[model samples]
Target: MSQANPPGRPLLASALGGLGLLAGMVLIAEGGRRLPPDPPSIAPAQGADHLKAASHAPLHDARPGRSARKVAADLIAPPPLDPSGIERTEPRPPLGELGLAPRPKTPMPRDWRETLLFRPVATSSAVFEAMGRTVAISGTVDIDPDRTCTFDNTDWSCGQRARAAFNAWLRGRALKCFLPPDADRFAIAAPCALGKQDVGAWLVSNGWAMAAPTGIYGKAEMAARNARMGIFGPPQ
Candidate 1:
């Protein structure tokens, strides 16, 4: 039919629109066939072609197990620095012993009259030495022969008792506990020079004072009697 149309409109509007729709469909089908099949998709295609992949993955669980391997590998090894390699030295004799006075030059002298207390409790000397690096021990430990020691009313050898007590006291502690002799140490004390009795007895009977690594003397008696402990100061 020759349909009359308005001045503003084209006559076969419906037919033309239909034809355009058919062309679009044909183009789409053709292009799809011409394109390569999509690479195996792990996700959805975009614009009907490209696809999206998983944003989340399955989490793996850590095995809860105890094994010898874990224990062996977990251990940390200790660092080594040989201390014996370092050269060491013995302490110089204290100046107070100008010739062998048996005591340092201190103003404080031993008070053999009960001003001090003597209660010797034995412990590992090595342990004490290791803990307090600066600590030292000095006493009448090295008295010469002829010095009489009485134990239970019998004469016991001075040297024998000193050696035994000294040795045993240091037994059973760490090897590092004992310090090498001759370390330049400050005698907070010096050895005691007991004339008649043993160190224990003398110390008790004459209440004396001694420094850490120096001498032991009757400090209480000296101070009271104004006896000269000599140059350094009273035995600390």
Candidate 2:
């Protein structure tokens, strides 16, 4: 028979093995604590690229990686140029170049009815000269300078006497006459006044001149006729 192994020897060997296993476990735990945690897992660039590509894809195509930069550029491009051509218009010619005469100005109606001042020379019982124009007193009948009147069945030159009397009253005084701007140079029927005295009124009132059929001196003429004054009276 073999000699029996020592129990103490076997037990001591098993204790040594247990101590080695414990030391190995402790070393592993300490190493794990000392080491920096595994670096955070890096995200792959493909994930970001996939998102970017998806955003750029067209909605209708459903494809995930197609770029729309060229389509977007075309959508934002400027409009096409206009096709119509510019037309030039001709300028109008001046009146002088066109040989056209200038239109004459028309006088205002108010100006034609204005009153005029003139120094007059008595020409007869109802006519006078002013501004180199002969004017007859309106509203009165002019008596011829050679006219005659009969009183007591005797004829007398009443027209000459009336003219003389009118000249004496005038004494070369200035007169205000209402004459149209286009009055004729000859005997124009203008109503005239000396100071505040109406020449026609004086003539009709004194019976030196006869009142016109449509004149305002009818009352004065009647008074002169009833009084037998001037031509209605005896020659003076």
Candidate 3:
């Protein structure tokens, strides 16, 4: 008989072969898992042509051959203003051209009457200063310096006494009278005052001068007449 193979040796060789076969199968599976995916299929000719035309077409028709700077400027620029609906105003015509009287220049304001101070010298019972250039006290009747009055059946120079009395009362005091700016240096019947005392009222109330018909000193004159004061009474 031929020499028989060892039993353990055969079994060990069989195990080694099986292990090598299993290792080769595992390596093949791993290689398949790591492979790249397949590429996509190509498009049709018509679709490819359409895509090429779109890519070459201009973005805007109004701006031909536009540069990058100009495109950026257009993006940031303000919109143009529309002035079609705005209303335009016309200049006004002059008054003379419209057949109307030229607008009268505003008349310059006239000077206001001003109060003047005067140191008067009595000429008569109701007058101050010279005859023609006198400040005749307003609202009073002038008594002539030569006038006479009869009291207790005795004649007396009443007018002279009245003038003397007026002079004494005045004592060279200043009088204030409202006069026009254009007043002339002539006799003017103007109301006057001496330290808040009305000259005309004082004369009429004291009986040194008679009140005018329309004078405001009627009541004062009546009071003086009733009291028989000043010239109304006997000479004193």
TM-score list, all predictions:
0.19, 0.51, 0.50
Candidate 3 residue spans exceeding 4 A from truth? 1-112, 130-133
What does each candidate score in C-alpha RMSD? 22.1, 26.9, 25.2
Better of 1 and 2 by TM-score: 2
In model 1, the runs with Cα more than 4 Å from the true position are 1-136, 139-141, 144-147, 151-153, 172-236
lDDT of 2 at 49: 80
The lDDT of model 2 is 0.81
lDDT of 3: 0.78
Clashes of each: 35, 0, 0
Question: Model 1, 52-104: lDDT tens per residue?
Answer: 23334434555777333433543565557698798878977877745565544
lDDT tens readout by residue for model 2, 1-236: 89999878998999999999998899798875664578665379677887798899867644888554466665699767565765668966766734755445433446556465566777788998877778899889988888999989989999999998888888877788877776754568877888899999999899889998977778799999999888888989
Give the Cα-based TM-score of candidate 3 against the true structure: 0.50
Question: Alpha carbon lDDT of residue 84, candidate 2?
Answer: 72
Q: How many steric overlaps does candidate 2 have?
A: 0
Which 10 consecutive positions of candidate 3 have the poorest summed lDDT? 105-114
CA RMSD (A), model 2: 26.9
- How many angstroms is residue 225 displaced in model 3 relative to the true structure, after the best TM-score fit? 1.1
